[model samples]
Target chain A: MNIFARIGYAVMTVLAQLGRLALFTGKALAAIVSPPIYFRLILTQMMRIGYFSLPVVGLTAFFMGGVLALQIYLGGNRFGAEAIVPQVVVLGITRELGPVIAGLMIAGRVAAAIAAEIGTMKVTEQIDALTTLATNPIKYLVAPRIVAAVISMPILTLIGDSIGVLGGYIVSVYSLDFNGSAYLKNTADFLHSDDVTSGLIKAAVFGFIVALMGCYNGFHSKGGAQGVGNATTYAVVSSSILILAADYVLTALLFHK
Target chain B: MSTPKIQLIGVKKRFGSKVVLDGVDLTIEPSSSLVIIGGSGTGKSVTIKSILGIIRPDEGTILVDGEDITHINGAARDRVMRKFGMLFQGAALFDSLPVWENVAFGLIQGRGMNRAKARDIAIQKLAKVGLTEDVAFLSPSELSGGMQKRVGLARAIAADPEIIFFDEPTTGLDPIMADIINDLIVSTVKDVGATALSITHDMTSARKISDKIAMLYGGKIIWQGPTAAIDSSGNPYVDQFIHGKAEGPIKMAVKA
Candidate 1:
């Protein structure tokens, strides 16, 4: 009976949290559509979440792409299909690795930052100050971040895809003794517009998850500095897990046909 | 007689099983200052927060200018909020913005005033609080505690609001600084011709800044009167509190 009661409590807690997130998301969407949209704040967040993230995303994509080519070459050697390296690299990057890697990286960087800053503001009563100043914290703080993340993630993922294929080209031509132009031709030929667009779509959803989780945890944070620390950790962990889970669901939906 | 500038009737707020404000009733006339004094964890802050619409009361109506604003929100709430300015306990200035920008936030964001005009008004308000124009460009983190409080005061009065609230405006300052802040509070409230509500445990500040004083204990205002009459109120709780006596009816919740 005790175990059953505990399990029931845990389930109830999870459902309560989900319900809260749904409400928060709904409010955020409403704020996004309403007047008094903060274009300046949105632009600043774009620079922080997207532009500053380019180096890390580009580097991660490059290395992952190089490793993918090597692994596919080794696996193909075993099956006597080494010529399929370019096709697999481009497909893997555009369809899966690029969006997922960029999402996780941003989940670590932007989500943690948003949570810590907002959590501090919450503890310090700056949010209440915002209210006293006649500004909606959701419109002024949360909406800009959500809009920025949704807009920037796809652009970042697109750039990341190109860099990743370039990485595969580098490894194949320089190290694996394949002609560069042929590797490029195979990557371009096998990579359809559908694959790239699908990754971009996944990237946008992941971005929304990152910002929303960050703002939600931060807003609910209490108990001062330790609580802010907890909020930051929760934001990163939850967004990372959600990104991976969402990637799988998106992939299934996009490729099932 | 005339509609009280602010009124709270039978206000109640509870957190889970712990009831903070069982039923708080209070009134403040126009262009007056009322200071609510209570021990920490009492409902003084809750009462003010309820009036500010920061915390919605579970069972009561709050009226400002004879309008029931207890449950109003969105544009209507924003409209009511425009009449208020609050000086928080910790000065709660935005760290991301400069001092002038913090002061001008309500003007620029809430009223849609342009930067140049807002900047001019912000500097003037800062000067009113004894802050120099050069101090306007510095970040809030650069200011000392008293300066921050002054800046917070400047921000609160920047838009010449009709009502102002001070939440422990003198907490965490030196004695001299606290006295200075109390003086500033009195002068600024006068300057704006605004109804003022303040919550603090500091008796000295309460007496110095308020025309009337209220004592809150156990989630209710136990005794209230003009500042001169608080000393003779005769309510043991009020007497014990103002005199800072531990050996009275009010028991300290100290754990062994």
Candidate 2:
């Protein structure tokens, strides 16, 4: 084939692959309409993908909140307006830093794990075995992860948001020598409902993206050990990249003010 | 004569310019084992996958018990699949689940049986594969390779499926364990009276478990006959693959 033809063929091949993936996603959604909801399986996935993700998300959020408080204090001090530190720290964590950090951490933890688990299953033919047993794999496997991620991420983000604000609160009360009531009041006054709502919304989207990327890379992984390893790496890297890009887009839309 | 349990006519599958299956036809009888033997990349796995609807053929009609089931979708396709049990080559047991939960996966998840009931059946199936009740609670990662294969066998038979597919079941195991697995395959298939389709390069597994042996080459089943007659099949491809000869009609892509 000519070079032009080869390029065209490559593009077409990519499109065709996308079409196949779209078809798989549709089949998974269709299976969701069937009976045998597998509620127990969903709950089990929720525990694994969501509930278990707390400690990592909490630690990351706490540290981030403290760091944000310190940075804002330093930057505001340069302007002789260090009092803005509390407002800036609370607003930054609730609006951007909190959900994005929590989402990225969960993505690193959950997405890579899900991808590796499911990818290994794919290569070994466990997914095929499920099909042979009359179990729709999308419902039995992918759907639960997706649902759990969407549901659990918001809750996890809220907790992270609270802990992160508290981290900022601790930093401000002790190091910045701000009165506790004033710090709390400044935080309360400066942070809007939209800021928190936007973060939670971003968390849900990030969770969806993370789970989808992980499951997608995993479900389609070929070869043996090398294929699964590649899938796990792809899941983490892709999820982190997508999380950051999405944060920018969402911030622009949700907080144009 | 019994009706064919599974039949594929003029099946074809191609990946881009490369063809994986070229006009393949196969018929599997009920309550018997048919093992497809081929060197790697000859499409034995692809054939089984096509039968299971894991990979759709470009042109073919796959009939299960005289039903043209090539294009059915959603709930109907799943209903057709309920009759099958598969013991994958690698034993594909879920690492996240305990051994019993893996075996009873279909029983509870697919059939909506309560956990208590599924656990009972799970333990029973595990026992039949030479495992005790204590082994049921361990993760699949904790088991030895041989034990893993047996657990795979247990899971395959757990639902009492009418059909079973084994894809390279003996790959990556010691010869002794391979023989053990071969024995287990024969006895279990006989016990359940389930129709079996297996793909293997291992001549020992092919010889031990197959009542009928089919050789796949160039994307077609070039020779098929009784297992006892594979020695004198008279086909160069079959002879070469069976004996593991380096120089034969079936050439490998050897690099310098």
Candidate 3:
């Protein structure tokens, strides 16, 4: 009976958390449409969330693409189907690796950063100070971040996709001794626009998840430094999980015949 | 008589199982300073937060300028908030912004003033707070605690608000700095002619800045009177607190 009670308590707690998150998301969405849109803040957030993230996202995409090409060549060689490397690499890079990898990397880098920054602001009563100053915290803080993430994620993912395909091309031509022009032709011919667009759509959703989780954890943070630390960790962990979950759902929706 | 600039009637707030404010009723006359004093964790901050609409009271009403603003939100709340400024316990300056930008935040964001004019006013306000124009360009993190408090004070008065709240303004300062802040509080409130509400455990600050003083204990204002009359309030709790007595009706919740 005690075990059952504990299980029930845990379930209830999880539900309560979900309810709170839903409300926070709704308020953030509403704030986006409200007056005083804070275009400057949104642009600043874009530079922080998107522009600063390029190096990390680009490097990760490059490595992932190279590794994927090598593995696909090696595995296809075993099956006597090594010639499928170009088609598979482009398809894999565009449809899955680019968005998912970029999203998870940002969940670590950007989400944690957002949480820590806002959590410190909250703990120090800067959030309350904003309130006293007649500034809507959601409008001033959360909306800008969410808008920036949504706008920037797809752009980042597009760059990541191009870099990732380039990585695969480099590895296949230089290391695997494949004809570089033939590889490029195969990748371009086999890859439909839908594959790239699907990944981009996923990237945008992942961005929303990352920023929302970060801001939500931050706004709710309590105590002081330890609480902000916990918020940073929670923001990364939750957003990473949500990003992958979202990726799966997006993939199924975008690619299912 | 003119309506009290701020009033709290039976304001009650609780956090989970902990009741922080049971039934707090208080009033501040226009252009006068009132300070609420209490031990740490006795709801002094909560009282101010409730009045500021940062914390919602579970029961009762809060009136600002005689308008019942207990549950007003969105634009109405923003409009009400425009009448107020607050210096948080930690000064709470935006580290992302330089001192001048921090001071000018309310003017730029809330009032939609242009940057050049706002920067000019920010510098003036900083000078009023004894901060030089060079300090205005430095980030808040670069300032000392006392300077941060001064910058916060500058920000509070930048828009010439109707009311200003000081929360533990001198908590982390040395004695001389605390006295300086208290003096600044008195001078600045006079300068703006703004009604002032402050919460602090610092009795000297309360005595120096407030015309009226209220002592809060166990979530209630147990004693209140003119600053001069505080010595003769005859309330044992106020007597205990003012004298810094450990053995009295007001007991500390210290445990071994």
Candidate 4:
């Protein structure tokens, strides 16, 4: 094919994929609000997406906060601003790092799992089985994951934020020889409510993106085992990219001032 | 006479450039076993999916009980689906649920039956398929292929559906097991008085279970007759397929 033809084909392919994703998102959201809600399934997914995810998110956030404090201390030492560690760490953790880190972790864990599971079901004709059994695949499979992720991310982010701040406090007081009481006072005084709420809002949007990408890729998977593997990989890649992109957009809108 | 139980008129489906079903028309009578015989990739599964509203035909009208169900959605679609029970090629039981739950899935999820009641009916259906009560609590993955097929058969008959579709019911079973399944299919279908539509390349299973046979070739039903008359179909493709011949009017797509 000529260069122009190749370019046109690429554009069309991207547009087609975008269109499919949009349609899938619309259907999943509709299923979420419609009747015949499966509370049991939703609760089951919460345990998987939220509760099971706590340890990983907590560990990452703690280490991230400790590293951020150390880096700030090193940078601030040159400018005679070492005391700025607590304030900067709290600001960064509550506003950005906590939610984004937790989001990425869950995307890696939950999104890949959902994609592989559903994609296998598709290849094995279990999804078709569900249809023949009078169960809507979107309502039975996709909606629960999406709803669970949406409800879970914000809560996970809140816990991650607290753990991260505590990590910074530990590093600041014990390692950096700072006064523990004064560091706590500084972190509390420096952090604002908007910082925490904005991060949570970002978490919710990231959660939606993760579940949507997972379901979309899995539902459209074809062939067999190889196809399911590809779906799982794509779910993680697309959701991670989307999470980062959404973070920037949400950050601009939420903290523009 | 009674709207033929199920009807497909000019059903056509295409995936990309390849046409799977091209203007195929069929009528399945009530309380009769009709088996569609064809080679792999012959649109046999697509035909059943089209009738079940899983894959909508690009152009066609599908009627169930004389009512057009080609484009029904939501609750109406669910109601239409409640009339069908399908046994997939690989049994397709949900690995997440145990054997009994797989059988009772439709009753509890589709019809809102209490779990205890659904479980009772599930066990009864399993018993009808020659499965004992001990197999009910086991996961589908724990069962052998023949046992899984039995569980699939039990699930199909669990709801006492008006129409049952078997997609290659005996594809991977041994001859003895396959014959046993064929007998169970014929007897249980008769017991429930349900219209049975099965698709298979297995000539023995087809000949054993079906009262009538339809041969599909080149995306169309080329010949259909009573099972006894299949030998005298006089169509080269039907003869080639039924007799398992390599050299015939219907050429296999083999790469040299």
Position A60, candidate 2: lDDT: 87
Question: What is candidate 2's CA lDDT for residue B65?
Answer: 89
lDDT values of the candidates? 0.94, 0.88, 0.94, 0.94
Write the residue-wise lDDT of candidate 2 on A1-257 in tens digits: 89999999999999997797678767666655666676777788889988899999898888888888888888888989889888888888888888898888988899999999899889877888788777878878888788788888888999998999899889888887889999999989888898889989999999888888888889988898999999999889988998999999999988787
- Give one digit per residue, the lDDT tens place, for model 3 in B52-90: 889999999999999999999999999999999999899
- Report the lDDT tens digits of candidate 1 across residue range B1-256: 7999999899999988889998888999999999999888888888988988889999989999999999999889999999999999999999999999999999999999999999999999999999999999999999999999999999999989999999998999999999999999999999889999999999999999999999888888889999999999989999999999988998766531
B1-256: candidate 4 lDDT, tens digit per residue: 5678999999999998889999999999989999999988889999999998889899989999999999999889999999999999999999999999999999999989999999999999999999999999999999999999999999998999999999999999999999999999999999999999999999999999999999888789999999999999899899999999999998765521
lDDT of 2 at B21: 92
Clashing pairs in 4: none
Q: Which portions of model 2 show Cα errors greater than 4 Å?
A: A1-35
Residue B252 of model 4 has an lDDT of: 69
What residue runs in model 4 are displaced by over 4 Å at the alpha carbon? none
State the displacement of the C-alpha of residue A72, model 2, in Å, after optimal TM-score superposition. 2.9
Candidate 2: lDDT of A21?
Answer: 68
What TM-score does each model's chain B reach against the true chain B? 0.98, 0.97, 0.98, 0.98
Q: What interface RMSD do all candidates show, one decimal each?
A: 0.5, 1.1, 0.5, 0.5
Note the DockQ of each predicted structure. Answer: 0.89, 0.76, 0.93, 0.90
Name every residue pair that clashes in candidate 1: none
